[model samples]
Target chain A: MSFLLWLESTGFGTFVRESESLFAYPTFIVLHTFGLSIVVGISVVVGTRLMGLAPTIPLAPLNKLFPIMWFGFAINLFSGSGLAAAAASTTIPNPLFIAKIIFVLTAVAVMVVLQVKVFRDPEVDDKPLDTMSKALGGSLLALWLLAMISGRLITYIA
Target chain B: MNYSHIHIVLNHFPTIGTFFGLALFLYALWKKKQDMQIASFVTFMVMAVLVIPTFITGAAAEGAVSQRPGVNPALVALHQDAAIVAFTLLVLTGTFAWLALWQYRRFNAPSQWTVWTVMGLAIITMAMMMQTATLGGEISHPEIRAEGVAEVTAPPEGEEGIAYALQMWMVNNAWVWPTGETLHFTGMTLLFGVMFLVNFRLLGMLRGVPFSAIHRFLPLGILGFGVTMTSGVLMFNADFHRYVAVPTFFLKMFLVVVAGISVLYVTIFDDTWALGKGDGTALRHKIFAVTNTLLWLGAMYFGRMIPYLE
Candidate 1:
């Protein structure tokens, strides 16, 4: 708790919370949003393919998307940390903020399972995906969307 | 009642109608009833088409409620932005459903693949509808607001950036706002139509139509993108502060970057080039096509969301 308050009182935090300039805190928020869209958007598209929505589109090349997905994560990690730092005292205690974290973690776990267990499976190209992989793809989307919604709701309730 | 009131009254129909339509579609999917699916597609299609007015009236709603006491301009902006995004997805889902119906009517029945495609789109659209509804609920209902969420403070009265001549002129002129908005929608429609053709082709729909044939129409969509990009900037310059303060606008700009990158990618790396009937496209290229389509739609979603989420 002390740490959060200390961080919030820092010069950076004050700048974010109190800045009138468009380029300051708001730009960070925007970057986070884009990072999120890329991460979540690619996940949805890849997941959709896994579920056999686009059967003719072969699975071999999907390996290329992992890097793009990671790039989005990097953006989010940087911007999210900055955003969180700016409002630590208030944001840390916020239920929605907590919920967003939980959702994001679960999404990450699901994403890992998707990347390691499903995408890396040797039979991915030859056989239909197991029912579990399909279900995980759907869950990944749901969790990330929940996180985004909760994060957005923070502004509404606060 | 004015536009807002009419919107409030009519809004329930689309939201409720979606559930009713989805229920029917689900029933059809379960029973494998082609005819039933066709009927439900039409139902979904009608529901999607009806949302257009609600979306247009939304600006009017903003106009009406913006000045009312206890109304937060930021909340209204967020709700409006969220609504536009949901509406865009709804439009895409509806158009896809219409195609499904056409497939059935012309061919005597759609393939299993077509049914699956429709189901996938419906699931996505339903999710968007729920998101949109939730954001809309937050506007007047503070009780529903997430705990500890701060109300967005209004920025200063005036916001002016570098101010290009035409952009400044449009922003200053009241008449230009609506004109820009109308053009924005027209551009959106043109882009969506082209996307439908291009994306569906990538997904193996319109198989008889060659990739090169569809390639010919890329410029039309690019033109639409260009139009919207210009209009969007004008709109932004018009009310710089509201948009800048709104987080969603920044997100929209990011999506535009994604869309722009995808356009560059497609021009250079679209693996479908030189492909024809009986010629297969590379998997990587198809993935790029799909990604680009979603990126643009995502951009559109964020663009509309700017006002409400901002």
Candidate 2:
């Protein structure tokens, strides 16, 4: 606790406490919140798609929306690190902090697998759900949702 | 009695309203019921209804906050100004959405005009949501004041100096901020749209599309994630301390990570999705998709709460 207090009061901490820059602080906060929207928003579509909600649409075309999801990921990565720098000492120890890192690592891994196995397969049609594909989709959906719920809990748990 | 309180609540109303609508949409999807779909659409449209009142109330609140103690004038002003832009975008997007829905309901099949109109509205609404959220951020963080100046003096030596210098550099470089915000919005739309699609598929709504096909969208999802991450870092680099300290911030980040990991696991090890084979993976997709939806909803809940809490 003493260390936490000391860290918060240090010169670096003071700058965070006292500095005024529309771009530096506010921009990050905005981006962070905005990132959440993207992250969750895309998860809704992808997750729902896996569950068989919109049958009329093609999965490949729907994949067109992936760029946006990646965009959110990119935003959070930088924004998240910047935020971490502010209070590395405290944040490093925080349970939420550890969870976030682990989650990101796993999410990216899942994404990579998705790319290699599903998207790359030329034979697979943008047609309908089979047993295995549905299972995969369901799992992907769960990963994203868990990510979101855990994200929200960060606010309360800490 | 406090105008600020009123305005904050008013401005925030649409955001909450939109979520409620989305929730309804999710519920509809879950039940595989058309009524729920209609109800959800109606809920979403309510965003239009609340937009004007939110703006008016927000304006009033801004005026009051400027005069109050402990509130930074610059921050209040920034919030007020950005809010106006958000309000304008919301109103425009809401109108388009309403018209699209109207056209959708009245006609046997949606026309090109209506389709384009609805698409356009969705795009615009997403953009506005990004701007509105950004402005909301300014309300709390005076350090990020748009004036491109900082109150924190530079620290001496080592990590502190580097951090301070970086923060100052971010302030001095003005061009990046606007562009960053724009990119953030683009990423936001992509992410939201794709996520919606994923959720829709999981609930057994889109039976025709192969479950494997959903994986194709992952690339686009990644792209959106990229944009969001880039902009996010710029902000974080500038103000590491406050954001790190904020409780909700940590939570949101954590949830995002979890969502990402779940995506990976589903894509890799799961052997359940065999398109139209012996059986369909609908049940599995449903369960995971539902869980994903809940996680995101939780993130949204906490994200919204960040501002109101101390």
Candidate 3:
């Protein structure tokens, strides 16, 4: 608890919490918002495609989106850390915040599984999606939605 | 011109343009002219882009007139309510029209469902546009209110019927604002993702895939924009005073216009449309792609800075 309190009192944390400069908390929040959009947005498109929407879109080429998603993930990781550090004492103990982290992490794990098992398949584009792939896509979508919901609710609930 | 003047000037385009586009579309259907059909589709798409500014200016116009002695806040509210519904339908019609055009480019003809969908949406949207226009006129032009306008009771001095209720609900409910924020961010993600895919393609990132295949997903981006704009208006309505005072809000709005117009170039221009697998983009198209990406980034940046800047 003291460590968390110390983290919250650090210069970066203080800047995030109390700085009037745009580069401080505002910039972190902006990055977080942008990152969320990219990661969740691409996930939705890919998820729907797996469930058979926009079938004409060739699957292999969609590997391009993963790199972009990773870039977004990087931004989120950095910005989310800044935000968490700012409110470490309060947010670290909040169950809602923890749920958000779990949802996001699980969603990321699902994305990796899809990338390896589904997207890496040589026949991904040539054949219809199998039941397992479709189920994975559905869960990926569900998990992301949960992540978004919990993330948004963190402000209100805590 | 002031926002009121701009609103008045721009408002006619969506209403009258829809009528003209619908008429031309019907004639094109009868004549079986693909060029004419494409022309109407382009008109619908341009109007969609223009409506963003028109709606924004309408809010500014309301601010200008709402405090006047005889302005009637209730009438303003009624107009706003009608405008929201009309704006939604118009955006949907425009999206369908874009889908039709994309289908035409890809399949040599738009699918039957897409064609019928645009027609149905256009017809209904035209009617709503007219209704919105009538309500808008009644807000200031008492001469046009007519005897039948009495059906809309003047709520108390500051209260607007549905609009007032919605504003209060948004303010009072803790969940509503955060929900709006979530959806707004979701919409932003959708718009950004689509923009990233399309713009990156133009910048030569996805070289092997044909632009047409990626073009198929443009509607999703437009849908995202539609969502963002709708939720944005709701949030703005809930807190217009604070929003209007922020300089960054104006900068963000300006960037939106530039970015909105720039995206249309990618949508309708033959230069980018003709790009197939392994085809490099022309220098000019690449420049426009970079400008569009930066404009979008600027819009998001300024939007996030709205509260902090002021």
Sort by DockQ, best first. 3, 2, 1
> Which candidate, 1 or 3, would have the higher TM-score against the true structure?
3
In TM-score terms, candidate 3 sits at 0.87
Q: Write the per-residue lDDT of candidate 1 for residues B74-183, one digit (tens) a residue.
A: 76765665666667666666656665654454345666776777677777777877777776776677788766333765434443222334456885775676666655
DockQ measured for candidate 2: 0.15
> Which candidate number maximizes DockQ?
3
* Docking category of candidate 1: incorrect
DockQ of each: 0.02, 0.15, 0.51
**Each candidate's chain A: what TM-score?**
0.91, 0.75, 0.95
lDDT of 3 by residue, B1-310 (tens): 7878889999999999999999999999999998999999888877877777777778777877878887776677778877877787887888888878777776778899989998999999899999999989887788888675735666675555555677898999888899888788778877887788788888887787788777777778877887888788789878876887776887898898778767666676688888888888878868878998889888998898787788
- Candidate 3 regions exceeding 4 Å error are A116-130, B112-117, B134-153, B156-160, B261-269
C-alpha local distance difference test of each model: 0.66, 0.56, 0.83
In terms of lDDT, the poorest run of 10 residues in model 3 chain B is B150-159
Off by over 4 Å in 2: A1-18, B1-191, B194-310
lDDT of 3 by residue, A18-85 (tens): 88887889999989878877788788788877887667677887887888899889999999999999
Q: What TM-score does structure 1 among the candidates reach?
A: 0.46
Position A138, candidate 1: lDDT: 81
